[model samples]
Target: MPDPSLMEQLRADLTTARKDRDKLRTTTLSTFLSEVKNREIEQGRAVSDDDVRGLLTTAIKRRREASEQMRAGSRAELAEKEDQEAALLQAYLPPALGEDEVVAMIRDAVAGGASDVGGVMKAVMPHTRGRFDGKELNRLVREALAG
Candidate 1:
């Protein structure tokens, strides 16, 4: 059987959240679904699962940044809210690779003749994309190349 689209999954989850009276989850999922719909309208077509994943990734990143800024400003309550929202959004993302796993992948790329940082990143990104943070991967690649 074909996989259900990401939007369908999100809508199903939204319904469940509403039924459970999970206000935070219901709000987050609804807002995200609206964003996805807007993007679809812009493109005049249904977006792929990858596109939905990208949108989720962006939302999570924004929440993380806002959480950090709020913490820095000593607003613990607001920071906590952002953290919760980010966690909710992250539930839809693919699990991230561990540091050791990422390091191993970088080593393999370097061994495969990716000598410079840029070359290693280019080699590793395709394997790591959506499963790892680019900044963390870049740092690991640099350390692997330098060592």
Candidate 2:
């Protein structure tokens, strides 16, 4: 059989998590699924894999921030739970590009006539979006231009 789409895979995993009574995984999946549903309704169409990935990325970022805040507040247990949820959701994203790989891409863009940060970013963002964090990618692009 053909592989299921990311949405289908996520739903199937949610079912499995529920069956196994894995509380963390179940809560993470349920919350993500709701976000997916909300995005679908907002856009008035089914989400593509890329759209789903974006939503997953946003959810993971939120969890990361919450985890940090919890830690700062001395809620280690809550912080740990947030970290766990973030890690669980992170599994659904595409593998992140390595630093060297992203640098090579930046070099190529620069060599191809992108002399400024804005231009280099415009050239590279399409290829790297969702694969790397925006701030890190910007730093790489700026470093490339500055070098």
* lDDT, candidate 2, 8-64, per-residue tens: 999999999999999888988998999999999999999999999888888888999
Best by lDDT: 2
Query: Candidate 1 deviates by what RMSD?
Result: 1.8
The C-alpha lDDT values of all candidates are 0.87, 0.90
Consecutive 10-residue window with the lowest summed lDDT within model 1: 125-134
Locate the minimum summed-lDDT window of 10 residues in model 2. Answer: 123-132
* Model 1 segments more than 4 A misplaced: none
User: How many clashing pairs per prediction, in order?
Assistant: 0, 0
- lDDT at residue 135 of model 2 (Cα atoms): 91
lDDT for each residue of candidate 1 in 24-141, tens digit (9 for 90 to 100):
8999899889999999999999999888988998888898999999999999999999899989888887788789898988888878888899898998887777678888888888
Residue 113 Cα positional deviation in candidate 2, in Å, after optimal superposition? 1.6
